[model samples]
Target: MQHLLQIFILYLFILKIFGDNVDENFPQYPETKQLYETYDFIIVGGGSAGCALANRLSEIENWNVLLIEAGGEENKRLMDIPGLALQNQHTYFDWCYMSEPFEEAGLSLINQSICVPRGKVLGGTSVLNHMVYHRGAPADYDRWENVFGNPGWSFDNVETYFKKLEDVAIDSPSLPDYFGKNGPLHVECAEYRSKLYPAYMAAAHEAGIKSELLLGPNQIGVECAWKTTKNGYRFSSNRAYLVPIRRRNLHLKLNSQVTKILFKGNVAIGVEFVCANQTYTIYSKKEVILSAGAINSPQLLMLSGIGPKQHLAELKIPLLKDLPVGQNLMDHVAILGLQFEINESPNVVEDKDMQLKEFLYNQTGPLSSYPAETIVFSHLSNGIPQYEDDFVTSTYEQQNHELYHFSSETWAEAFLPNNQSKGAFYIYPVLFKPKSRGSILLRDNNPFSHPRIFLNYLTHPDDISYLVMGIREILRISEQPSLQAFGTTLYKNKLRACKQYEFNSDDYWICQIRHLSTSLFHQSGTCKMGPKDNLDAVVDAELRVHGIEGLRVIDASIMPEILAGHINGPVIMIAEKGADIIKQFWANRKVG
Candidate 1:
């Protein structure tokens, strides 16, 4: 009895001597926060999905989670304000990466220069985007089942997951589909949209288009602005996911760049990084889930010698896995800043200071978020016909299947979209499913080096036609009487405006696009998801990388195609569901 008492006392003394009574809600990085010294799980890239997974996994209390993030936390004041999302673009929280300049573009973005602002902070890209909460069309995931061999990834399965992460505070009551109460993430609507919104919708209706409530019974029509904002603040994944479950059990590493994934045969053993000036190697007992975005995920895989053999040989890196690592990259490219001198300034941009002040005081302001007040999910006049299996790339064995499909056949398939566009009500469109595909390759073996991202935009002749058709649609909407009411003529007055409105030929539309094209900012499919038969797929339906064990890829990278709407919401749902899948698998294995 005395010995047992002595042992108990000794244990208590040791715990009091070393254990942290640290506040559970406070932030701690993996480099700094080590509760049990080693964790049960290690999640890489603490972005939208990564944080959510980490938070949920840490709920076990005794279980430890080590979350590795290249960026620091930005889910605070500046990032939480919807209006300030753009300001963080050039700040330290942003991984401000630019594309190799293209001569065709009017240097507005870069000489072919595409500036990609990745979140170098806790919430990842969610900290940078306009925070729109679009679940996309139900048919989106249905198509995943139809096109790929992914059986259970339909909307029915994913909707619950979406609800699990979100606690939506919809400002508009007429909006159907209430947000879940017990969810972690907060979603709200945009407070202030440019006055151009109404005219934009009216013009779409006038052009024979219809509106479809995004989360309602269907997704085949025009929509409304529903962003992930609460009141007037941005509701990032970190705010909803990581911050809530931050305790000693969960370690978050920031300002740490993962150098390599140390593997033993097929099992991923651990990861190494350059932190501050020192290098650190952290082992993962359970797994290393990669939540790096479309660009970086593939880049990391390739740097770890998991890409194509030819590409690896070129870079002189030994190939670890020959399966396609950086193939089938797809993104949406749109024309930006189509000018219609506002009849009256929507003033969202002009009154930035007052809006900021009001927000700072009470977190309420018009400019708090984009009043994507009305969203339209319409097919382009030049868009691929809504035939079944249009985006099915699973059976195709070719590397450029998507590119060839988009570049070749679209010329005769599309119409001259109505260009009589309205000037107000904030008009922005998302191409439902683009056929164009791209790839990522390492410039060198160095993990710190930026990889080469070739979007191969408009590589397909059909792609050019659709882009041209999109230009014509923009022209059509701009020509509407509602838009013209504000001296906002939609006729091509691009800096490289068509020489004559009457001579608006295909060449003119093409030239206008080449000059004014903007990235709709959806980069996807770099690390595609599907079965083993999917030649270009990097991970299976379970999101497990093809040739590795105890490793998973969850992020925008695993998307099979560019969804019809913003992919962020869907990506969050994926992470949420993935956490469950992983948890259940581990639980069952433990029982066994």
Candidate 2:
């Protein structure tokens, strides 16, 4: 125990030493800078992708890689608390950009976009997310490779990289074989459970469905959630990739915003950034990679004159690559949320003073970062058989021999609405793959102006149809025998009855959804990766912007399509693989 404590203290000390260097107030580089030679690689956006790239690229001692972030270093406090993420939104720590107005959202934004809050801190969204670590259905990656024509990006091919980035935080016996042990990001058990978790699972079972791992034998089942946490702490990319070795060689620049990429003809020579009273330019000798996530990535690209010709012409931004930069914005949009109640449990909102004390005192209890209780995955469509995605639950059976049983065909994952929740319980019915696609545009030339996020949500006729089907399923599960005992209530006076039960108005059910709908926040696909001839293709399989040199995009923006689950896990893996790709590219350059 003493040895373990020593190791833990050592880790914290090292992280603190590294993280201490980041400061918006850190003596700003003089306006008239002492010009250095050049770095071999320059990665923009110190979010998930950027951090991974920097960590991986720096592995080569000879390779001088510079990572430039527009945000501050990782805040250990925020890194360890899950529920506080929402509270940080719109603060100095967040970009706090609102979306362009929308009509479908009931004129919520007056046709103005809604608020978009992305982390401006070290870990990026990972620091701000609910921390449910789900690597979407395997089929999604297979489709991604097909769409982008990349041989190595297939689910099977990318599995190795995923394993390399993930460290399961659960006991060995409780995990599947595919999960790894010594990875960077720690994926642990549900941080805090809700009163409804067990009932939700039991109710699903009562309805003839089994509580099993969605990634198990079949993807049709229901199961609990697996989060991206470590030792009861939030595990963002900054935590895994940045905090350990930040002070070593990384020139992490916070409160520094990139204005434009300086190019000599087609080659990106350096970048211009505004620090305080003055602007500065940093040079990159070999490459400039963008990892500013889905929204900012495209916005930056367009600002640099690398988007569609007509769009740039209208915006008066010079056209560098007329290549659909912000065309295909996709997000995991879910109808608001459905709420349930629990009279007995001590809800997360009940006691904040105590919770804060718990965190600061013993480092145990609700203060731990594991926010969401559990997340269940299932394929609910037209009586479809469960599709075996990436995850599967393996178990041991009787007889000196252990028989493996899969638990994914029918499952339900529930989170007890702890302090992290807003008093009531919310079940967000996520539509993994929606036909609807949105667009991200430059609201104006001002880098601080919020981008126009025209999320013509439900624009695809089928998207709402699937949602209606999911609402119906949500209602069905609520009425299951097990849940009936819990006295769980629906939105209102039974709008649409279960198939075997009574019925109501279609409009009524739709109304319930609109009123309850909330953002699952899995936004992506703006700078889409696809085959060269594809009209909306922004980058190729190599993650290289189609028509540009010395520039590549390496964030969720490159996702050609949305996945079957949460995007955090996949994005982390993408960064890990991207690092390898960049490393190999440079290595071969030397070899050749």
Candidate 3:
């Protein structure tokens, strides 16, 4: 009877937190009523890049900036809880995009298509994503400059922008030179460490992988993940970049979906959008920046008749400019079925009442951290020293891998059936750089319809081989003495699709890879940025759309190649640099 009562009370608490009336003391951002017919700058998609861009540009005082978002204000009561990060998916806060069916991957999923969750809220994906703060690798930016012909995007040139946006509060061996003491974004190590955390680190050490800070000089090894949080709460891009500067000259319009970019001949003039059953067209005096992420940004450009001539003509939309608007789609693919059973339960309070009380009072409990505790980066090839300076310098075609350590019950409940037993954890081996390329296309002429996304995962044989090798590397780590002492063993359930092959054979792993392939939510490279001579390039080094004036793309879509790690940090950095570039262009124009 006591147990039943406790469970009932806990359920009530859960309802209160997730309810619509939960009190979060933040200022209510009602839609700004003060209207402006024309602004100096208009930024579409108040996402990670858009928020930062609006904050920086509005500092000029004279430049009135407008930021339009397709979603409502962020639900702080639900989003502030870190452990509930994955719970945000499929909710109203998420775009909940469904990928087009592909036979090669996601065979086990419904209709052989995966669900891609992009945030539709004010902060964009930053509000919906697991708050892992990673800066990718320095070599990634070097390639953007040398190989892609983007002049000022080298590691040395962009590192300052990274420092300018960070406020590192973690205690680690990471040097001060690599981090900023005061910046808007607050980054810290996850405060709540499960018992499995130490065991996982020990297992990595026993397997010859050293423990090192990923944000430090080295890129390969195991470490506790740094998150974008503030005082045990999720610090989304909206909170970091927009909240503090709400009083500035920036006007934010929520729930406004942009349908097309309005152009006057070769120059972008404004945008046409719909809000509350009303269609409106607003103008921009200086520039219109598109930061609607990898998927929607390309869709908007193509809808505005700036895509391939044949594709635009098929839909009967007249062409204004001939360019490859939605090519080179890439994302980090991962095998989702890798699981292991361990003897020890996760280091979390089993009592739901105590868990809630601890979180409400002190903010030091399992609810304070994301389910993913640690991340590992490594090369699958042999004969390469792990600690060499060239660890991150390998070409994108090589076999580079990243593994995620997820809590036991969280992994099972999310991916497996309800009948599956608990006390199991997951080690998902992610292919950081995939050679397989995909594309985004318009389903119809209707701007309200969701765009068709095709992430052609594992189409390249090299990509499949890399994932196979990554699985082997993870199995070796499971055999280490540290994990063995905990009585860790692989979950022996055979996927129904792969039951024909021997369980542990290479062929079986490959089958599993195809059936349960998932994305790490790092989709990019759809609108390629490069030199003008490159036929595939859509934007120039300055992020200006080719042959178009007063228009630019300033988001992950402009990445010529996707970076090796999470993209949120890099997107913010890009916006910081982009803000400077825009300021410089106007300042020089005034002088001339």
Best by TM-score: 3
lDDT of 1 by residue, 374-456 (tens): 65555522222211000000111122112112211221121112222222322333344666677777878888877776766
Worst 10 residues of 3 by lDDT: 390-399
Model 2: CA > 4 A from native: 1-37, 106-113, 171-176, 215-218, 246-248, 346-352, 367-371, 380-424, 491-504
What TM-score does structure 3 among the candidates reach? Answer: 0.91
Name the lDDT value of residue 588 in candidate 2. 94
State residue 404's C-alpha deviation in candidate 1, in Å. 28
The candidate scoring highest on lDDT is 3
TM-score of 2: 0.82
Q: Write the per-residue lDDT of candidate 3 for residues 250-337, one digit (tens) a residue.
A: 8899999999999999999999989998998889999999999999999999999999899999999889999999999989887776
Q: What is the TM-score of each candidate against the true structure?
A: 0.82, 0.82, 0.91
Question: How many pairs in model 2 have backbone atoms within 3 A of each other, for residues 3 or more apart or on separate chains, i.e. clashes?
Answer: 35
lDDT of each: 0.65, 0.64, 0.80
lDDT of 2 by residue, 432-490 (tens): 66776778888777776767777666667666666676666666777786656655554
> Which has the higher lDDT value, candidate number 1 or candidate number 2?
1
